[model samples]
Target: MECPCCSGKPYEQCCEPLLAGRAAAASPEALMRSRYTAFATSNFDYVWDTTDPKYRDEFSHAANCDWMSSSLFTGLQVLAASDNGKEGTVEFIARFRRGPNPEARHHERSRFRMRKGRWLFCEGDVISG
Candidate 1:
């Protein structure tokens, strides 16, 4: 499959390793990038698979698909990532365009958890507009 990030690469070369359970992302920022790719492609299975099961329901793929399908995710800029190997945070801005809007930014601080050598998305705290 093509990369959801539109980086002119295949998903296998871009984010598939992380999404397919073949490897754990090297850092929180990398994991966040792959998650954004998952969102852009409406790959609910990957989204569900990478999330901490406790927070899996936080992403309602069916409800999200409508908006997700309509928008084109342009890029991701990671601002910061910190903490140790087990717990980390990543703050990033995702750029997307929907209909008449040229492109808007969605910035948030996302939390990650590493359990048994695998990284899982916990939740995100949206900081601003």
Candidate 2:
């Protein structure tokens, strides 16, 4: 299956390794892509696990899972990505459709941080939707 992140690679070769715990996302953009794939597949556990612990309480697993499970994720576009050794950022647009509504676009710039040698999503600023 094609990767939901639109990386043009097979799912197994792209995000599966990360989702299955066989590998860690090597960069902020990689983590961002895998998170998109997680949402696309309704793997809510992966989504929650990859979030920075400090920010986890700001979100609710049940709510996020409901949103992801209800939406049909269509595609992802990474507009920009950059990282230093300890911090990173990814600017992206994700497309999805919910219920009978028209396809919607979520544009955001996400932040990430490295902790104990693994990258984790910290937060995101929504640009538009």
Candidate 3:
């Protein structure tokens, strides 16, 4: 199947390796893309697992899974991304609609940190525009 991140590649060749723990994302942008694909595919566990441990306490796995299952993801647009050694930021807009509700977009600049040679999502600052 095509990658849900809209990376113009097959899922197995794109984000599956990172999501399956077979490889690490080469850059923060890649990790962010994988995370978006995970969401689009309703793989909430990947989303939770890739998060920085410290940030995970704010969420429960079941709750995350439930929330994700409730939405119908449409697309992802990577607005910008930057890497500086151990720290990085990926700005993106993820489009989705909850049930029969109107479609909406979530714009955010998500922060990530490299830990043990793997990128982990840290936090995000929502951008409304």
Ranking by TM-score: 2, 3, 1
lDDT of each: 0.82, 0.96, 0.90
- Please give, for residues 1-129, the per-residue lDDT of candidate 2 as tens digits: 899999999999999999999999999999999999999999999999999999999988889989998999998999999999899999999999999999999999999999999999999999953
**How far out, in Å, is residue 33 in model 1?**
0.9
Candidate 2 regions exceeding 4 Å error are: none
Q: Considering only N, C-alpha and C atoms within 3 Å, which residue pairs clash in candidate 2?
A: none
C-alpha TM-score for every candidate:
0.83, 0.98, 0.94
Predicted model with the maximum TM-score: 2
Q: Write the per-residue lDDT of candidate 1 for residues 8-125, one digit (tens) a residue.
A: 6788887888777787788777778888988887776777777899997677777778777888888877788885988999988889999888999999999998977878889999
Q: How many clashes in each structure?
A: 0, 0, 0
Give a tens-digit lDDT track for model 3, residues 27-122: 999999999988877888888888999899977888768768898888999989999989999999999999889999999999999998889999
Q: How large is the C-alpha RMSD of every model relative to the true structure?
A: 2.7, 0.8, 1.1
Cα lDDT for residue 71, model 1?
Answer: 85
Better candidate by lDDT, 1 or 3: 3
Cα displacement (Å) at residue 50, model 2: 0.5
